[model samples]
Target: MQYFLVSNDPDRRARWHDRLKAAGLNVTGEYDPSAVIVTIGGDGTILYAARNYLEPRILPVRAGSSKGNRAAFDVDQLVETLQALEDGHAESSSRTFSTLTAEADGKELEGGFQALNEISLHHSSPVLAATFAARIEDDTTWEFPELIGDGVLVATPFGSTGYFTAITGETFTDGFGVAFNNIHTPADTPEMVLCSESVVVEVELLSTKRSSGAVLTRDDDDTPYELSEGETITIRAGDRTVELLDVI
Candidate 1:
């Protein structure tokens, strides 16, 4: 089977390359959509692969001191695990995870604004909290007229274990999770919701503070979309899903 090894460390990749070659596995120099991605790092490595290669099956291998939530095997076990798959002695199951898509003022962002984790809209300023109105349109509608806070986020089940957990101190099994970030006003505070994946979240920038506006962040992307006042942003589950190759 065709496979690719991904790593940020060049030395590690070189060593892994030698190991794989010794074990009789060829590493593709170029990314092949059909090839299984073998990432040699932590959760960040896996997430990076997940975002860049949407359709490839990922084999996350933990290495060094990296903490990987989705790593399937350690570095020492990688060769053996992969051999098992090749010999049909073991199998890899696909675990599908949902993704996020966002739009600004009804127009989809560039490159479709797809994310594997959560989408956030927050105050761009450092000291002041932004005011925004959030509405969850689903089976049962819920709305907060004016939320004065750092910002808000919409997270998928896979994302619930990340920032959503840090903010709400909870993780959910299914559906999208919503968290209110550092709300200044106690009144009209909206509780965190773990609603269906079909739910649509709308955030209206209402902050009137000087130079105040919201920045929309997708996953851990460094570049975020600017959300001006009076503009609305929508977050929803994307149709595309990520498949991880789980060794079993």
Candidate 2:
């Protein structure tokens, strides 16, 4: 299969490019939708590949000092893995991961933002905690009382291992995980909630006498969607899924 190599580190990319070519693998300079993405960086590179390519197969190779939690192979095993696939001794495999989508005030955003991991809404200012309210729909509709906190995040199971785990100290195998960020009120509120993938989570930055707002960010995207006071941001599971290649 044709492969496209990508890395945030230029030196690592050049080195790996030579190795793959030396192994007699078919590598391409330009991205092809049909080509498998060989991500040669940290776990973040995997997310980057998935975001830029449309349903492209991903082969995540661990690199650098970061913890490559989503990596499929290590550097030492790279050429051997390719040989195995070439010889039909080991076949390429894949796993499907879910994604997320958001809307503001009942309208879908222009970019059709879909996050392979989590979508977070945080207080706009560092010194201020925003007041927010959440409405979750599962078997029944439940409205949570207003909360005073830094913000909140909704993560998929594939995302549970990232920020979700850091904030809630837990991971899930399926469904969406909802967690509050540094909440100050309703002290007894559950740290996290595991809801069905089919559930809908709506959060609003409450409008008070003071101007309050939050910033909505997705999966390492540089762009942050802004939410004004009284504006509701809706988060839900996307209809599509991302496939990772050669997962062991």
Candidate 3:
């Protein structure tokens, strides 16, 4: 079977290249539209693979984490899993993916904004809290006072198990539609309640220092944000949904 193999670690890359080859499968460094993508690593690596390797193509992800920040699943048995794919055991897999959209200034941000988890707005720098009006799609905007801590985040059920759980957002079951959780501020909580599917939210920085206190990010994070107070950040559910292999 043809598969898309992606691994940033040179050592792991070489190891898997040899291993998968020995397993009797055709592997390509680049994503082949016709090939299933197998991300070899932890969930984070899987996320990275889905984003950078097969983002536009949007294929079902067969992922496992080796280890890192966390290993939601196991990696020791990946070889067995690989064998399953080769044996046609992965064909019955199915999973749903979630995404977020953000627009700064006027132009839309590009590349890797889609998050399988939640989209968050946090402090750009150590300064005043991120304060702005948040409105769900099709709703009017409501303003908030200066923020005290970092910022707020919105996560889906897939993401609910991640940061949202740590922050006390309720765990959202998968395949029940999208979830909005991990809200830090009181106003933001009510704001999300009013949110709808694919709702558009605008966060306007109220701090005048151009404190750039707030920035928007998708699931994987690590994006460059140059926003200041009064600069608006527009966030909404994305049209692109991820397809995860394996129901669980």
Which candidate has the highest lDDT of all? 1
lDDT of 3 at 224: 52
Query: Lowest summed-lDDT stretch of 10 residues in model 2?
Result: 205-214
The alpha-carbon deviation from the true structure for residue 92 of candidate 3, after best TM-score superposition, in angstroms, is: 3.4
Between prediction 2 and prediction 3, the one with superior TM-score is 2
lDDT by residue for model 1 over 122-229, one digit each (tens)?
888878788889999989999888888888999987778888999999998788988998887765576587799899999998866876567898887888888877
User: In lDDT terms, how accurate is model 3?
Assistant: 0.57
lDDT string, candidate 2, 47-70, tens digits: 888778887688888977868788
The per-residue C-alpha lDDT of model 3 at residue 67 equals: 42
Model 1 — TM-score against the truth?
A: 0.92
Q: Give per-residue lDDT, candidate 3, residue 141.
A: 44
Please write out the lDDT profile of model 3 over residues 108-131, one tens digit for every residue: 676436666777776666545555
In the order shown, the candidates' Cα RMSDs to the true structure are: 1.8, 2.1, 4.4
Point out the worst 10-residue segment of candidate 3 by lDDT.
56-65
Q: List candidate 1 segments past 4 Å from native.
A: 186-188
lDDT of each model, Cα atoms only? 0.84, 0.83, 0.57
